[model samples]
Target: MYPFVRMFYQAWKNRNAPKLGLFESHHSRHVCMPWDIDLWLELNNGRTLTIFDLGRVPMSIRNGTAKVAKDGGYSMAVAGASVRYRRRVTTFQTVDMVTTPIGFDDKFLYIEQSMWDQTGECCNHILLRGAVIKKRKLVPPKELFDLMDPTLESPELPAWVQNWIAADDTRPWPPTR
Candidate 1:
């Protein structure tokens, strides 16, 4: 189940936050609720991804991408993602999440997010490839960017992210069983 209530809370909490530049980061805090745990009693890997949406969507709102998407009648979708889990996040533990737009290419907008424990140790990190869509068809990121700010240019993507992109390109789609 999606954390729709928590998502609304996050959005409401950040409604008055200062508008951020396209590449700026959005900082937020969240707790690992009982339902967020797995059989091992740690944050579930799948739930971690969903919680990431709590950060990304609000970040987009603060950065004006949400407005652009709304006014243009476009929707944002996650086309791909890669996550790395390190430390354990147990129930009731709080974590600080940072989300930032890494860059964009011709097709997709890239964003990075990480969750850190109160001790400042990173528990997990995720990289997302997002797409703008209209009428069920893909829309170029540049089109979205143009609506947000014509002068906005994508920052250089990190080499690791580029490598990940290159690697993903080699994968067969409609994956073989």
Candidate 2:
């Protein structure tokens, strides 16, 4: 089951956070419960992604993207993502998550996120390509950014992200079995 209760708690907890600029970072903390673990007694990979959502959504709220989308009747979705898991997060251990907008292109907006364990070691990192939706069609990121702030100009996407984007484009859709 999706953690609806935790989602609500995060929203309520960060409601008064300062508004963030388009490229600024949003930080939050979370703990790994027994339910978040896998057979190895460490944070499950899938749940780690969900935890990243806990960071990103509240981030969108603090950065004003969520409000702009709501007011404009648009919604957001992750078009693609790549994650790297490097360390274990045992039960009851807390981690700090940092999420930031890296940049955007004509098609999608890119965001980078990472989770740091109590020891300050980065346990995992992910880069996501997100799309804004309206009428079941994708909305260009610039349009949404314009709604948030006309003065917003996307910073140049990092080379690593650019490479990943280009590489993803080469993969056949409906990938062959």
Candidate 3:
């Protein structure tokens, strides 16, 4: 598998150095969870967005133009995602997952995705926090933030966003997009 945030995080924990791109024994899997794809797809086409698009952001940060960008309103930035699994999921089976944007201050945008199988049982839940950066700064660039305004109103946000924000009590950040 290729080197990614999670794999590198684990490598840092294990005292294993990273090899550029991918390594045999260092990384195992790099599959994008469904929810992330949905947002990116929606951001592009707004009509035909799907789970496939949600999983493509890591590779699309640059040299990938959004399908629906008008001029320079949107651009890719730094971000990271983490997922927990209870059972193995095969690509053959389609799953139902609801996603929503929970919050976005200045640097971080939090999104939650919940997956349920055909039987209506929760299979996996994931939270993705993306930082919108430009030229290595923590502030959200004005142009990109304008594009994200339409996205913030998406119904995908789960019902528990407020609670999550309350629980998320991190370091005080008074700035925002």
Q: What digit string (tens of lDDT, one per residue) describes model 2 on residues 1-177?
A: 788889999999999999888789999999998999999999999999899999999999998899999999889999999999999999999999999999999889999999998888999999999998988999898888898778878888989998999899899999899
Q: Judged by lDDT, which candidate is best?
A: 1
TM-score per prediction, in order, is 0.98, 0.97, 0.43
- The predicted structure with the larger lDDT, 2 or 3, is 2
Q: lDDT tens string, model 1, 33-117?
A: 9999999999999999999999999998999989989999899999999999999999999999999998999999999999999
Error of 3 at 159 (Å): 11
For residues 3-48, write the lDDT of model 3, one tens digit per residue.
Answer: 2554344334434333221001111222334432333332112211
- How close to the true structure is residue 10 of candidate 1, measured as C-alpha lDDT? 97
As for candidate 3, its clashing pairs are: 36-54, 37-53, 37-54, 37-55, 38-54, 99-156, 100-156, 100-157
For all the candidates, what are their Cα RMSDs to the real structure? 0.8, 0.8, 14.9
Candidate 3: deviation at residue 176, Å?
Answer: 30
Candidate that beats the other on lDDT, 1 or 2, i.e. the better one: 1
Q: Weakest 10 consecutive residues, lDDT, candidate 2?
A: 144-153
What are the runs in model 1 whose C-alpha is more than 4 Å off? Answer: none
Ranking by lDDT: 1, 2, 3
